[model samples]
Target chain A: MRRLGDRVGMAWAWGSSLCLLLGLGTLLVVLVTRGAPAVGPGLLFGDTAPGDAVLGRAPVFDGIWPALMGTLALVALACLVAVPIGVASGIYLAEIAPRRRRALLDIGVDMLAGVPSVVMGLFGFGLILLMRRTLAPSATTGLWLSALCIALLVLPYLIRTTQTALDALPESLRLVGPGLGFTRWQNLRHVLLPAAGRGILGGVMLAVGRAAEDTAVIMLTGAVWNAGLPAGLGEKFEALSFRIYVLAAEYRDDMQLAQGFACAFALLLLTCGLLASAHLLQRSLERRWKA
Target chain B: MSPTSGRTRGERTAELLLAGAAAVSAAAVLGILVFLAILAAPAWQGAAHVFTWDWRPFHGHYGILPMVVGSLLLALTALLLALPVAIGIAAFAHGLGPRRLARIVLAAVHAMTGIPTIVYAFVSAMLLVPFVREVFVHGSGYSLLSAALVLSVLILPTIVLVVHAHWHSMGKELERTCAALGIPRGRAVLRVLLPLSRRGLLTAAVLGFARALGDTMIALLLSGNAAQVPGSALDGFRTLTAHIALVVATDTQDAAYASIFAAGLILLLVAAAASLTARRLGAGNGRTEAARAAPR
Candidate 1:
């Protein structure tokens, strides 16, 4: 009886993970079944256009090409702004900054990272509205505001990972660089950077995943429900997650619902791919740095 | 060389550039605070309409207390339900399972963290809603319960990963000692591992609570958008994040626009508190917290 009870208890321990597996498994199965019908040639190939008003849109269903492009643009713009700052801040925190000042700055970064996505959107709205009211009276929601918000969002993660990567290096490497007659700048550029490249790249990839799929920030910034591809700096744009959201909430009919699912699948696929690569690189960073 | 002694011009310039970039992050946070305060100034000074709980269509009582209470209730429900499951998974994956199985479970939790929040919202909107509606026999499945259910799942992966890491790092020695003394692994785990990592458990729960609190889409899609005082799990209720997301888009006028910022300020306070707690907990302990705090 005692042995049996112990066995049951051990089984219960493992069973804990079963609850999580089941919940996620159910979500995956439901989405696949519901969304699978919506995936086809036009879903990936064609551009998304407005329906109902035209009584006809496109023969190939005019998939989310525009939203896909918009998502790419959002991530690209965010990375372009944040990458340099993030990488630089990472090195500063890891190698150079004063300890007391770094602690205060770290708290600020953590707070920034913790701000909810919608609040970030609110900030972006205020930014554009402020510009509209004062500087550019005709200014509209645009790419720069969303990029800035997302860049802020992604900055903390990048900085953290890069710092971790740099701090993980052996003191011997730092000493060796100096002993070999390289200056501080040269040492960082040559030996230290090459060693930390995988980790920094992993962090960058994770930030890309974050900026690409962020809905709330982009929703209130530049993203539109169904607009033509964004043309200029201040022009409104469409995004995959936002498109899914508006469609899901409004819920016109079954066809629209199907389109929402397809967009979701595409969004999920993109983020998942990016995250998977980041995960592999994170593993490599851990393995290589330790070895 | 020390900072003041042998610093060359090239080194000084490079260091200054790096430090300037770091300053940009700090400035962004301060800028957000100042901007939010400026935008929210009108609401603080405005008419009392924005403070009422009876929200009506197009324009209604803008009182934010109901949404605040609703958000609190939803987060409480999710935390209460998720804590045990997360603890169980973490403990099991760290101790009870074989090495390969442990690796797989941890990987699964990590992958789940990366799933976009909108995908979860979509699933809940489609599947959880009607099921909840049928079970409760109330408003469509868009209820506090549904919101709680999805948010619980959303934060579970984070909590489990955090708690599991804590348990493995801090509790494993005790487990090994108990096993060598002829104790059952389960008893040892319950008695030794669980108690030893109380701080981690608390942090895990706190991080999970914050994530659930800030989540907008699950509540927005599943929680019936009913901006009123919540009655029960079956009743639909609005959350602060959801309310902001819903109203901020359309409320471009005077007090109403400022009211959204006021709502944002409340969220910022809560988020700031969470950040302080995370900072105290040390940087390396809560990887999932950062992941959960960001969008999706």
Candidate 2:
């Protein structure tokens, strides 16, 4: 009876794992076969024309050049906002924070990370409302608002990764700076940072992939349709993730639905590329640093 | 000069700036909570009806009980769907599979974490929706079951990653011990490893539930947004996340807009509670906390 029970448990494990892998395989195959053909210069760089409109007056199909650029811009802006603050805070926490405060600070960061993206979006929307009342009388949801929210959204990832990376460094390197009469700032800038650069970059790549694909925050913070390329930080923008949602949810025909799949494929390709490179970068850096 | 006793202006300035950054990072959490509270103040005017079942904002009814039910139901169902697979994958990676298979399985799980929620929703919208609609012979393909199915795939990585991380911290000592004692592999895993890692499993489930509850796209696109308590898996229902998304898109005035704020507040509280519970459960297990904190 005991042997039989053991056999059942082991069989269950193998069976479920096989099912999961098979499901994933099927998903990848469907996405690739259906979406691969839509990957072309025409799809990447062209505009959504009036002819592409199905049921609505506005076009339903998108070529995604504008969205591609918007995603890149949003990610760049978010990185600009997140990296410095996150890295600085990380440096403070890892190197200088009091032991007691460190625990409190860590919990704060964790709770912030746990906040749902939609709540973040609501916060961004509230910020826009606050801005309209005070800072910018003409304030509206747009690139800057989305970028700011996404920055906050990804900040915890950067901080945690930065702290972990710095903490992982050998004590010898940490001591070399002080032993050589270097100040704290000099030690961090010259010795600690360079060593942890690859790891921090890996974190940034992960954060970028996250920011690019985040739809809920952007949906409330100014993702719009046929907005064209954003001319300034205050203008609304398009994104592939949002585009994919709109197309899939609102598509009128099979062709439009196919375009949605294409958008998904494009996003998958971009994020997967980043993930692969980040993984490789971390691996190579580990080998070089350890050797 | 010792590192701790530094008196240089540059060092002092750097420390102050870095500390300020940390302060700002920490304060942002409180700031979001306060802002949402302020935004949701209007809905509190209808506080009595807030807990009631009627939710038609246009008709002046402001209850959110249905959305609450929908969100909970969808998350619970998704957790039920994903839990077995999560445990199985963890066990297989632990030792039930070949070394090459383990490596491949781990890599696939890692990659799955990177896939966007939108991709899952899109695939489900295209494939699962039609299947559910046809097979169930119920409401249009968009139902709680459809959303739950898609969401199971979405939250799979969270549970698997946490459990796997906990097992790693457990190490191979137990396996070796059981083997040396002449215990069979499967029975050892079932009796020893499974029982030992039960806390880790609970932590994983709580975290996965939080993730499932917070997801908007699957519920938005696949759940059909019927704004009612679902009687069955085939019934369409609205989750808080989806309700907020829908309201924000279509309405920005009147009670409906304010109701979304109320919804946002509920989401915030639930998320905070879930995280707190998971953290409490995972407190002593630093590896579990690290895995839970990792960006999904």
Candidate 3:
């Protein structure tokens, strides 16, 4: 009877695992079959918007170029803002902060990280409102505003990863700086940072993935359905994630729906590629460090 | 001879700048709270009407009870669907599968966590919603069950990774003990490991719940946005996140706009409560490695 019960339990576990793999397989298969046909060079770099039909004729081609560009620019801008502050904060927490202050900072980071993206959008909305009232009267939802909000959204990931990476380093590395009469800043710049560079890079990759895929924060900030192209930091821009949401929710034709699926596939590729690269980089770095 | 005398001015400035950077995290948290609070404060004037269940913005009613209930219900259903599969996958990686296959499964899960929520939302709206409607013949493919189905997939990575971490930290000891005592692997996992990781499982569930509740796109695209409590899994409903998005998109009127801030405040408070509960549970679990991984 005991043996039978154990067998049943083991079967259940195996069955569930198989269920998950099958589900994931179906998801990917659906995306590939539904999305692959729409993913041509025109979809990659063509300029015809989905709505740009001339005199009742369907548009010759449609592309997500502007949205792709907007996503890249948004993620790049967010990284510019977040990476420096996040790394510095991580270093401060790991190496310089007092015990009590470290605890306070950790709580703050965790709390901020836990805030929902929609709330971040709300926060960004309020910031724009405040700016309109006082600082910049022309302040509105746009690329820069979206980038700022995304920076805040991904900040905790960077801080956490960098702090953990620095914390994981050998204690003897710290001793070298003091033994060599190096100042704390000099020690970090010359020894500690170089040692932790790959780990910090890993965190940056994670932050980039996060900033690229966020839609809610950008949805309220500036991302739109049919922005031609971004001309300035303060202008509305298109993003793939936002496009996916709009197209899926409001598509008028099967063509547009297929476009949405193609966008989904492109985004999946971009994020998964980054993730896989990050994993490989981390592994190779670990192997090299061991050697 | 003092160390202070030997420090350069550059070093002092760098230290000051780094400390200022650290303070920015604290400042951002305070800023979000203060901004949301100041914006939401005006809704207090109409607090009585706003807290009720009716959410007819155009009719001058702005109650959010339905959205709140909808959000919680969606998350609860998603968690119920995901928790077992997540634990099973973790158990597979623990010892049920061959070593090579387990590593591949773990890596796949790690990659899945990085897939954007929008992809999941789009896929569900395109495929799963239709399937659910066809099979169940329910109200327009968009319903609580459809959203929750996709939501479970979205949060699966979070729960699976957490459970895997918990098992990684604890399963080794159980394995060694079982080996030494000649205990069967199935008995150790079934009777020993599952029961031991109760706190960890609770933490995973809470984290997954928070993630599902906070998601806007899935709720917006698939929940049908009916602004009523769902009578069944097939019923359409609104969630606080989706409500906030819809209000921002359509209603820029003063009362309607302020109502969203109130909704945002509620979502924030709920998320805070969830994370706090998870942290407490994790601390009780007494495994810092697993706890650190929980926030993902």
Candidate 4:
């Protein structure tokens, strides 16, 4: 009877695991099959042309060049803003924070992670609207507001990951550094940070992937569907994620709709590729540390 | 002679700076909460008419009662569908599978954590909606059922990961002892493991609920954009998140916009409360574990 029960439990477990795999697999296959046939150099590089209106027309197959460019710019600016502050906070939490303060910081990060994306978008809109009304009436308000919102959204994740990496280091390393007469700052810069470099990079990459996929905040701030390409920070620009939302929601053109799918497919591929590379880098670093 | 004194000074300075930075982050989180409260203050001050079931954003009627009901119903339905499946998967990964297979399953579950919610919304809009509509024959493709189904998939990864962590954290001795007692494996697991992990399971459920509640894209894309109370699963409805997205997208600047802010505030409160409850449950469970360990 005991053995039979174990068998039943085992069967249930494997069955459920298979179900999860099937769910994700189905999603990936659906996206790929629908979007892959549309991918080509023309679809990748061309701008959305107005002439392709008929059913057989190539379906506004403009490459996602502008959306992709905007995403890159937004993500780059967000990373620039988030990484240093997140790392510095992580350093504080891991090495310098008192116990009570560390506890508070952990809770704060968790709460930040749990806040809904829409709220963030609302916050960005309200803050940016005020800033725009007071300061520059230029288009840069949306861009900078979106960037800052994304930076805040990603900050907690990076800080959490970096703190975990730093915590994983052996006490002997810290002792050795101080024994060698290195100051605390020098020890952190030269020894501790380098040791945790791969983990920190992994965290940053994860944050970047998150920033890349987000639409709600970008929709509220930077996104202006069908806008011409942006010339400056103030200019309204479309993003890949936001465009996917727009094409699927507001547009009636099926070809333009397919373009949205293609953009989504591209974004997914880019994110997955980056994640895979980061995993490889982490593994290599682990091997080096062991050696 | 003064080496220890100098090191202490530097450490103190670092600690002070770290405390200040952490306080800032905490303040940011609190500021969001405060902002939501202030935004919602107007609706609270308004007459009882605002609480009416009808949500006519075109008029001054900013009643969010229907939106709240829709959001709760959608999230609750998703949670009910997902909880059993997630627990079964977590149990299997931690206890039932072969060691190597378990690792692979766990990795896949973790990978699901990284997939963006918007992708889930997209897939549901493209595939699940059609599948449901075809099967139902009478209902529209975008219904509460479709939204719930999409959200179920979105929340599954989170549920599995949290419960799996709980299962793995149990001591091997507990399992071995139960097996040695000649108890049936399933009964032993029910009596021992499940009770021990009850708090963790509850935490997972609450967290999943919070996630489902907060999701905007799936609800927006699949709930049919109708501001109706769903009498049946096949009926169309609009959620708070979806309402905010739709309202903001149109750039409305009437009482409707203020109502959107009210909805956003409600969402923030729900999320915060859910998280706080989960954290407290987790802390209580930790104390129990420590108490259990103390006797031995």
What candidate 1 gets wrong by more than 4 Å, as runs, is A1-12, A45-61, B1-6, B46-49, B57-60, B171-176, B282-296
- Candidate 2: tens digits of C-alpha lDDT, residues A49-140: 53443223343335676787789889999999999999898888888999999888877887777888988898898787778779888888
**lDDT rank, highest first?**
2, 3, 1, 4
Instruction: Write down the C-alpha DockQ for each prediction.
Output: 0.57, 0.61, 0.59, 0.34
- Evaluated at residue B40, the lDDT of candidate 3 is 85
Best by DockQ: 2
What TM-score does structure 2 among the candidates reach? 0.93
Residue range B172-218, candidate 2, lDDT tens digits: 89888999999876667678888898888998898899889999988
- The true-versus-predicted C-alpha distance at residue B140 of model 2, in Å, is 0.9
By DockQ, rank the candidates, best first: 2, 3, 1, 4
Alpha-carbon deviation at A237 in model 2, angstroms: 0.8
State the lDDT of candidate 1 residue by residue for A65-152, as single tens digits.
6677678888888999999999999899888889999887887777777788888888888887898889988877788788888888
| Candidate number achieving the greatest lDDT relative to the actual structure | 2
CAPRI tier for the interface of model 2: medium
How accurately is candidate 1 docked according to DockQ?
0.57
| Comparing 1 and 3 on TM-score, the stronger one | 3
> Model 4, B1-296: lDDT tens per residue?
27765466666676567666666665677888787666556677774245668877666677778989999999999999999888778776665566777788877776666666667777678778888899998688899889998888788877777676566567678878988998655555555787788888998888889989988888988999788898889989999988888887887754665677788888887877876787787663332111111100
